[model samples]
Target chain A: ETAVFQTPNYHVTQVGNEVSFNCKQTLGHDTMYWYKQDSKKLLKIMFSYNNKQLIVNETVPRRFSPQSSDKAHLNLRIKSVEPEDSAVYLCASSRTGTEVFFGKGTRLTVV
Target chain B: GQQVQQSPASLVLQEGENAELQCNFSSTATQLQWFYQSPGGSLVSLLSNPSGTKHTGRLTSTTVTKERRSSLHISSSQTTDSGTYLCAIAASGSWQLIFGSGTQLTVMP
Candidate 1:
C-alpha cells in the first residue's frame, strides 16, 4: 500500500480560480509537510504541520493556506491562483525527526 | 537565499563510473537525509546519516554535523542510478525539513 497519497496528480485551472490539493499518509507519522518544486527544479518547503502546531515556511504567499483535520491528513488550498503558482507540489510525512516518506506529487498549472 | 545548498547542479557519467554529490548547509543541523527522485517520480529515502558514515547497497552517505555538510557517493554507477539527488536538513527541536537544490545525475550506458 502507498504510505503517502496525494490526489489530483495533475490540475490545470484558470487565473483567479481556487484550487485545493489533498494529501493523506498512513505511515502513522506525527509530522507532515508541503513542498514546491519550480520549473528550475528548485525544491523549497511551503508548510509543515504536526500534532503540536503548524509552521509556515515564511516565504510562502498569503494566498496559500494549509488545513489539517488530523495527523493523517494535511491539505493545501490556494486562493486566487496566479501563473507563479504553477509547479509540482509534494507531500511528505515523518515520525518526528525520522526519515520522511513522500507522495508522488501533484503538478498544478495555473493558466 | 538557500539554506541547504548542493553542488554540481548536474552531472553525467558513463556506466560503471563512480559519482559523488555534495551538500552544504548554512545552519547547524543535527539531522540530515539524502533522497533520490527519479525522472517523473516521487522522492525516496536513500540514506539518513546525520553525523558519521553509513552505507547501504551501492550507496554511501557521510555527514559531519560539526561542519554542517554531507556527501553522497554512488559506486559503479548505472543508468538506473540516473536521477535527481536531494539533501534535506533539520535542526534539533525543529520538525521542518529544509531541502537543497537537487543535483541532477545522468548515467549513460
Candidate 2:
C-alpha cells in the first residue's frame, strides 16, 4: 500500500547539470516535506509546504528549491547541482500534527 | 536548536530476543513518530506516540512529553526487523520533523 510516491528511484548526472524530482501523496495530508539523507544517514528537513504554501525553509543551498502546484503534489529542483548534492531525497506528508508518511526516495548522484 | 539523540547507536540480538531503543529530544515536541529505514533506504512509519503509550503488532512506543523522551520496545526480534530505527520530533508550532541519528539493529537467526 504505497501512498506517497517519488519518481526516478536513482539518478546520475554531472556536477553542473540540473535535476528535478517529483513527488505526490494520496493520503490527502495538509503538509508535505522534503528531507535530505546524506551518506551518514542523517536526515534533515529542507523544505516544508502546507496546503501548497511554503511554511518552513531550512538552511539549504541556493541551488535547491521546492515547487508545489497543489496540496497533493510537491517537486524538488536543483539547479547546477554540485557533487555534494549526492544523497537520498525523501518526500513525506502529514496531516498537520500527526504521523508522517514517506516515499521510497530518489537517490541522486552528482559526478 | 532542536535536536534528537538516540542511545546505543547499534544493537545486535538473536532471533526471539527483545530490544529497547531510546530517543531524547531537546524541545517540547508537538508530535513524535518512529520510523524504520529499509534496506532500499526508504522510511516506513512504525508508530506515532506524542505522549503516553501506543502499540502495534509486537512494537510498543512510549513517550513522555514532559520529560522530552521516548522509548521503543520490540517484544520479539526477527531477522526481518534488522534495519535502522529513526525517531523524529516536530517542535511546538512547527511541521518540520527533526530526526535522530537512528539506531541500527541487527537480528541474527
Candidate 3:
C-alpha cells in the first residue's frame, strides 16, 4: 500500500487548458512538497507547504499555484498550460529533515 | 542557490561487485539525504547522513560535512540494485532541499 497517493497517474490535455493534480499523504507529516521531473529526469522543487504557509520556488511560473486544504493534502493547479509544462509531477512529505516519502507521480502531457 | 553535484552520471557494475557514488555540495548543509529511484517509478529513501558514517544492510554512507562531500558505498551488488541514486542537501538556514542530477547505476548479473 502507498502511504502517499496521487490521482490520475497520467493526464493528456490540449494547450491553453487548465489542469490540476491532487496528492494526499497518510504519514501525518507536517511538511509537503511538489517537484517537477523534466524529460531528462532532472528533479526540481516547485513548492513546499508546511502548516500555515507555502514557499514557492523562484523559478516557478506565476500561473502555477499550490493549494493546501489541510495538512494531509496538497494540490497543484496550472492555468493556460503550455507545451513546456509537460513533465512528471511528484508529491512528497517529510517531518523536518528526516526521511521523505514520495508518491508515484503524475505524468502530464500537453498537446 | 545551493548546488548539489553527483559524479559518474552512469555506472555499470557486475554482480557481487562493489560500487561507490559521490556527492558534492556548494554550500554549507545541515541535512544530507540519499534516495534510490527504480526504473519508471517513485523514489525511496535510502539513508540520511548529515555527518560521519552510517551503515544499513549492505549499503554504507559517509558524509564529511566540513569537506562538503558525501559518499554512498554498496557492497555485493545485485541486479535489483540497478537504479538511479540521488543526493539531496538542505543548505544551512534553508528548509528546502537541493538535489543532484543523480547517478544511474546498472548492476548486471
Clashing pairs in 3: none
lDDT of 2 by residue, B1-109 (tens): 9999998799999999999999999999989999999766689999989999999999999999999999999999999999999999999988789999999999999
- Candidate 1 lDDT (Cα, 0 to 1): 0.91
Query: Which pairs clash inside model 1?
Result: none
Best by DockQ: 2
Cα distance off (Å), candidate 1, residue B42: 1.3
User: Where in model 1 is the C-alpha error above 4 Å?
Assistant: none
Instruction: Compute the lDDT of residue B105 as modeled in candidate 1.
Output: 98
Put down candidate 2 lDDT per residue, A1-111, tens digits, no spaces.
Answer: 679999999999998999999999999898999999999999999999986568656479889989989999999999899999999999999898888999999999988
Q: What total of clashing residue pairs does each candidate reach?
A: 0, 0, 0
Complex DockQ per candidate: 0.80, 0.92, 0.76
**Whole-model lDDT values for every prediction:** 0.91, 0.93, 0.93
Off by over 4 Å in 2: none
True contacts kept of 3: 0.74
- The lowest-lDDT stretch of 10 consecutive residues in candidate 1 chain A is A50-59
Candidates' TM-scores? 0.95, 0.98, 0.97
Lowest lDDT sum, 10 consecutive residues, model 3 chain A, at A93-102
In the range A7-85, model 1's lDDT, one tens digit per residue, is 9999999999999999999989999999999988778889989775888887899999998999999999998899999
Tell me the lDDT of model 1 at A13. 99
Model 1 collision count: 0
As a whole number from 0 to 100, the lDDT of residue B53 in candidate 1 is 93
